[model samples]
Target: MSPTVASTGRVPVTIGAMESSSAASGGSTRREATRQKLYEAAVTLIAEQGFSATTVDEIAERAGVAKGTVYYNFASKSVLFEELLRHGVGLLTASLREAAERTAAEGGNKVDALDAMIRAGLVFIDRYPAFTQLYVAELWRTNRTWQSTLMVVRQQAVAVVEDVLRDGVAAGEFSEEIDISLTASALVGMVLVAALDWKSFQAERSLDDVHAALSRLLQGRVSGCR
Candidate 1:
């Protein structure tokens, strides 16, 4: 999210939002715009149909670009998909980090940071449902070429949650014996799956309603017995 390269040592990929408005020059700006179009087209096609079923021709057609342009931007479909994953998840990671930092700047506790991150995740999923669907679907598929890249970006997002959990434990806000890694994963999984359900079946529900329900679960206030 902070433009850190994966330790895989391939190349230092700059992780940022899929859409960029601050390109330094006209050529860079045009290239970013073209890449964004390709990303949007690919996400939609891959979400509607499986990745293997989608082709460069379809992506080019959907993006209203020539096949040569796809090649010029990305060497192959797999590269495009991998970069797309990096771009989309990078944006999500940045948003989560910003939420946590903003809460802390306002004198909020770790719990408040976690709550803000939950809202950030919901906002991201709501804005980019198709990309979210594609990302979640690809998370468990080991055979994909982009699996390693997905894992790296996925950890970047989860590590943000884990950092808050670790801080909470240090401050005695969370149980000392709690498993930070698994708990972070579970929290992230909860928001992702719940948000997907909200978008798929409960399309009429507002974002605040969904966030409120998840917030209760996060704060462990679901049961009325207490």
Candidate 2:
């Protein structure tokens, strides 16, 4: 999936939610908390300064941990970055999947599922703008060490939207001539760019305002007659 940008804040919403779920399930809560800190620090620092310009020492310092703690969690700065990308995107994929599944369970149609996923994407971006920005920037660069990892996670996220589009076509809810892959990519791109713009340029606007505008577009009301 395409990534975007925003300022870093507390632990990302999705990640924090995942951590809560994991903790309830008897998972390693402490480790996850530490990783969350590192992820937050890395995203902020790397987003502000390019990945190469950011160092393990700086990440550890920002995270309020020793440099050795960084090495303990990740073999090197590159490994830490690769895992950070995976972790953040993985949470995003889960959120999208949950939104789609929840919509289906509620007897919503394919369009509804897609719209729900759009909101999920916006929420994720709104929560972790710096991470989104970092992810998007890495996607444009072909030389990154984690480029392969990035591609895999990206496809995993986009595949959720693609699946919904395929279902829509199968059910005759969408035109068979429509390109599923491209349309899925387009929908994701729309939310990513729109949400980034909302966070960066139109910070005064509420999420509901952005979602309503995008929902209108999804419902084919672009002419504003409906």
Taking all chains together, each candidate's TM-score versus the true structure is: 0.88, 0.87
Candidate 2 residue spans exceeding 4 A from truth: 1-14, 17-30, 224-226
Tens digit per residue, CA lDDT, model 2, 163-198: 999999999999899998998888988998998888
Q: Write the per-residue lDDT of candidate 1 for residues 50-72, one digit (tens) a residue.
A: 79999899999877889999999
| Reference-based lDDT, each prediction | 0.85, 0.83
The number of the candidate with the highest TM-score is: 1
Clashing pairs in 1: none
Could you give me the TM-score of model 1 versus the true structure? Answer: 0.88
Q: Which segments of model 1 are wrong by more than 4 Å?
A: 1-22, 224-226
